[model samples]
Target: MKVDGEVTTGLGKAAYFLSQEFYTKEFEKNLGFIPYPGTLNVIVSDEYLDEINEIKCNCENLIKPDEGFGAVRYIEAKLNDVIVGAIVFPAKTTHDENYLEFIAECKLRDELDLKDGDIVSLEF
Candidate 1:
């Protein structure tokens, strides 16, 4: 399964959640890699709305956040054909339905050399 989205600027605030000791430990334990201290935001395409929604609805028990944190679920996804997939979910975010967030083993910005306004492909 896969979804599509473009790189978008976030509020520069994922570190708040990603850096928490509780979440980081779980992320490393479940997601098979130590996530970087932040996430990459993407504005998903409209065509995949139902798919993303399905993921949200049925993705519980996979890697949900512990108590005191916002809800989350994860699936592996590849970025730009790299043999990597990010764990994606929503938090106490202001993003709309089109927006998705990602966490991975390495810094996505550095791995892909991406910049704002880049057209990137995220696949699972």
Candidate 2:
């Protein structure tokens, strides 16, 4: 289906295929492993500044991993004057680096049209 100028061929159909064939190969060649699924908080708003602030607030409230292997970072994607998506990274820490998962959840309390907010708890 076409929405605006973008196409949605069903939930994750495009991203899944792209990730498997293109993203995975490219990422592995450039980076390393197939990107693991990580969580992110998506927030959309007209006020970009406020949206950024909200992302910061959410990250501050995020629960840190007990193993000291991961942390949460917020990323905001904007489309023109409107905020599109807010991403939260639950990342793994290496000796001198960090790797974030590829799944995203919500952190905002307001009624925003975004994905659900599910707290991620993992051992590895």
Candidate 3:
């Protein structure tokens, strides 16, 4: 799956959850790296929303929380051909379908030199 959209800012609270030792440890173990303390927000294109939602409907498609954390689905993707990351949707999440959150081992914004409204390509 591939979804392209413009980069956007988040509500400025991801660090509270993402920076937790539990999730970072899990990410490092499963996703292959410890993510930065945040996610790169993307407003996915409307054309791809349905496909994303469809995956959400499939129970097997989601990555459940390790034990105490909220559930999230992980979709592996490539960013700009140089960086690798995943689109994360929290099962008990706050984001709308259009707003997909990208997480990488590195700080996505710094590595990508991204700003809000910059178009980002995500290939799964």
Positional deviation of residue 2's Cα in model 1 after best superposition, in angstroms: 2.8
Top candidate on TM-score is 3
Better of 1 and 2 by TM-score: 1
Query: What's model 3's overall lDDT?
Result: 0.79
Clashing pairs in 2: 37-102, 38-101, 38-102, 38-103, 39-103, 40-88, 40-104, 40-105, 41-86, 41-88
Off by over 4 Å in 2: 1-10, 37-41, 49-115, 118-124
Candidate with top lDDT is: 3
Collision count for each candidate, in order: 1, 10, 0
Per-residue lDDT for 1-124 in model 3, tens only? 8767989989877777787776777677777988888889999878898888887666353545567778766767788777887777786667777998888888888887899999988887
Q: After superposing candidate 3, which stretches have Cα over 4 Å from the reference?
A: 59-68
Q: How accurate is candidate 2 locally (lDDT)?
A: 0.31
Locate the minimum summed-lDDT window of 10 residues in model 2.
1-10
RMSD of each: 1.9, 15.4, 2.0
